[model samples]
Target chain A: MIEVEALTKRYGSTLAVDDLSFTVRPGLVTGFLGPNGAGKSTTMRMVVGLDHPTSGTATINGRPYAASPAPLREVGALIDAKDVHGGRSARNHLRAVARSNGLPDSRVDTVLGLTGLDAVAGRRIKGFSLGMGQRLGIATALLGDPGVVMFDEPVNGLDPEGILWIRNLLRGLAAEGRTVLVSSHLMSEMAQTADHLIVIGRGRLLADLSMTDFLEQNGRTHVQVKSPRQDDLAPLLRAAGGTVEPDHDVLAVHGLTCEQVGDIAAAHGLALHQLFEQRASLEAAFMDMTRDSVEYGSGSLPPPPDSALPPPPDSPDRPGATEVAP
Target chain B: MTLPASPTANAASPFALDGPVHHPTTLDVVRSEWLKLRTVRSTFWTLAVTVVVMVGFSVLVCAAQVATWDQLTAEEQQANPINGVSSALAGLSLAQLAVVVLGVMVISSEYSTGGIRSTFTAVPRRARVVVGKAVVLGLSTLVVGLVASFVAFFVGQLILATKHFDVALGDPDVLRAVLGSGLYLAACSLFGLGIGLIVRNTGGGVTISVAALFVLPPLTALIPGTVGDQIQKFITSNAGQSVAATGSAPDRLGPWVGYLVFTVWWLVLIGVGTWLVRRRDV
Candidate 1:
């Protein structure tokens, strides 16, 4: 397990990480979600002892990382994919890190094969593509076979197949009862891979919850209804305890499900043309939670012609954009 | 993208991996650093240039001296006799620059390429990493310097032998001068590394190293009087090259004393560098 207690890092006058504390437990993939400049990288750096904490501590396995007799054997972190020397071959680079911890050369070859880098291990890192570099970074992280593994934006430049491979790999790591902390701005990827989430914005904790609770609490869901006798249905729905906001031709109803709205419409003998439930995607929920905390909030753009328009689909597989009648 | 099974998958707990926890010693760090230094092409090329320049320049200078021997009168020859030690080590003035470039690159390239983060992350005791690099670079340069010095000494002596002016290895101060050439090159390498650590930029580190070793020595000559003479005696290159001198002049420092002063300069720079490296965020 990794525990951070009131960890803070200040650069000059700017607070890069401010009084942050979170525990990453074993057997789970904890998603560290944050907007750009939200101290995710700073927090990881402090955890690995790369950057000194101004006034707090980050410990791995109940001791400061620096205090560990064999830190690499206890914690493996891929803080930056491009941190390796470009001039060295992939195999030699891993060997240097391995030798630092007194790890055997056999372990280097194991990680090389594990990350699908065995074929290119002889090649110089400068020749590797971004995706290959990321894979090599992962290979380095797994070199020591540590219990705690952390990756920062692991899938930034991967192809579609590589993305799928990493998602499965993270899940597999967590399944083996290892602590995995992954940070990314991609909400869709987090929604799929993260078992728990620790969300931060502008160097402050905004939310910490499970994947299910995060979606249920922050992701808003509403019923979209259209009717010829919409004027009659509007009051009847509100009187029935559902908040109704009338749009051009549809009524965006909150606090009620599709069945409730349909039951009321049928009871009053009101004609309904279309009715469906619109569940906000995780991306939409994250946007709402961090709207004010964004470091570089783009100036407000004019709202769409319809205020009740549904958020874009979370992923291509979800088909969240298509309205379905039930 | 089928990942092989994780090595720790079958372990009862995440922390319970096989093998005793071995805290890395300084030796381990040195080995790792040696691997780092040898794996790069630049290290090989720089060392190659140092050897070639040191040996090549010595041979050419000795050959030129032999070619001009017959043109001088006996009185003129006696007044300006060829010093075997100086002749064999003449290449050092040029070869030391190559060693300086390689030394600065050893640490500065890590900063430029963002590789320092990986290095620091592996060995959180930041001072140990610096020590490791210093040890590896120092030892390797020392060996190479010795090799280059011996080769230049033998080859230069062989060339001067044609004119019957050759000096043997057992001649007074001849062996000291040859050995001193190696020590001088090693010191030059460390000096460059110290500058590199302090500056943390290849171009800036090389610029400062060259300025200290070459530019400042000559500039000190214009200081005008006893003060100028003293400053020139203590300047980096002048003091460092003193060790390779066969005969000491009254105004110059003793060979060992001059080398000691040169050693002190690098120690100060490297010490400050270690302190900064430990405190600074990678």
Candidate 2:
């Protein structure tokens, strides 16, 4: 388990990570989601002790990362795929990392094969493609076989096959009771792979909950009604307490269930061709939750409705504002 | 783009997380550094160039001296006699440039390529990583420097012996000079490593190292009187180069004492580098 408490990092005048705190538990893949420049990378770096925190502590398995007897054996991280020395071969790169933690040379070959880098293990890293470089990074992370693994944007330069491979790899790692935390800006990707999510925007936590709860709490639902006499049905639905908006041949009704709309339509003796309840996708929910906090959002666009926006920073109703006990 | 359907088939077997963990000591770090140093082509090429330059200059200078021996007047020949130690080690001045470049590249390349992050992640005690690189670079360069020095001495002496002016290794202070030449090159390498750590960029580190070792030593000559003399004695190249010289002079520092001063220069630089490395964000 990786525990981060009240962690904050400041680069000059810019507050990159502001009092962020969260726990990444074992036996699950926790997706760390954020918009661009939201401090996901900075948080991961601080967790591994690469960048010193301005305040607070990040501990892995009950102690600071550096305090571990064998840090690589305790926690392994791939902060950047391009961080390896290009002049060295893949085999040599893994060998150096393995030797640092007193791991056997055989482990290097094992990871090489596991990451499908065995064929190109002897080649210099400079000659490898970006996908190959990412593979090498994953190979290095798995070198010591640590209990906790963290990856920052692991799918940046991968092919579809490579992406699927990594998804399986992360799920497999978590299935073995290891703590796996992977960061990405793509909510759709996280939807498929993450069992839980910790969402952040503008360097502050917006929500922390399970996948099911996230979809249930943030995803909006609407009823689609298509009728032969749409003009007559629109006014009745609006008068009956549902916000009705007309689309090409249908009426999108919010704030009422499909059953309620159907019963009201029957009472008014309106003929209905089709009726169904549509729950907004997780992607749309994620966008709505973080729209107000996007760091580099397009400036000319009009603001979202007040009800769609999250609670203000100082508001007592804001979720994830206070730490939750694990 | 095509990968095996089951890429992580052996992942469960390889990552037996239940196994005992072994804490890495400084020795383990040294081993890692040694592997890293040898795996790069730049390391091999730089050291090779250093050896070639050292040995080549010794032979060429000795040959040129032999060719001009008969043309010198009797008084000129008496006043400036051929010294075996200085003659064989003449190439050291040029060879040190290669040594400095190699030393700087050892650490600077990591920063330039973003490899330092991986290095630090593997071994989080940041100072230990610096010490590990120093140990590996120090030992390897010492070996290479000694080999180059001995070869240049033997070859240069053979060429000088053709004109019957060669001095024997058994001669007073001759062996010390030869051994000191190797020591000087190793020190130059460490000096470059220290500068690399501080600058953390290849171009900047090389420029700064060259300026300090070569440009600064000559500029000190423009200063006049005892003040200039004192400053010249403490300049990095002047102090370190004295060890490789055959005899002491009134204006210069003694060989061993000069080497001591040179050692301190790199030691202090490395110390500052270690301290900054822990505080700086990678």
Which is the leading candidate under TM-score?
1
Q: Which pairs of residues have clashing backbones in candidate 1?
A: none
Q: What TM-scores does chain A show, candidate by candidate in order?
A: 0.88, 0.84
The root-mean-square deviation over C-alpha atoms between each candidate and the true structure, in angstroms, is 6.9, 6.7
Could you tell me which 10 consecutive residues in candidate 1 chain B have the lowest summed lDDT? B1-10
User: How many backbone collisions does model 2 have?
Assistant: 0
Q: Clashing pairs in model 2? A: none
Q: Candidate 2 i-RMS (Å)?
A: 9.6
Per residue, candidate 2 scores C-alpha lDDT tens digits across B1-282 of 211122223455545534445678989999999999999988999899889988998998899999998999999999988887788888888888888898899998888788988998989998889889999998888899999999999999899999888888898888888888889989988999998988888899889999999889989978999999999999998999888887768767899999999999989988887888888877
For each prediction, how big is the interface RMSD? 10.5, 9.6
Write model 2 residue lDDT over A82-197, tens digit each, in one string: 88889899999999999988888989988998999999999999899989998999889888777789998899889999999999999988987788999988788898899999
Q: What is the lDDT of residue A78 in candidate 2?
A: 89
- Report model 1's chain A TM-score: 0.88
TM-score, cand. 1: 0.92
TM-score of 2: 0.91
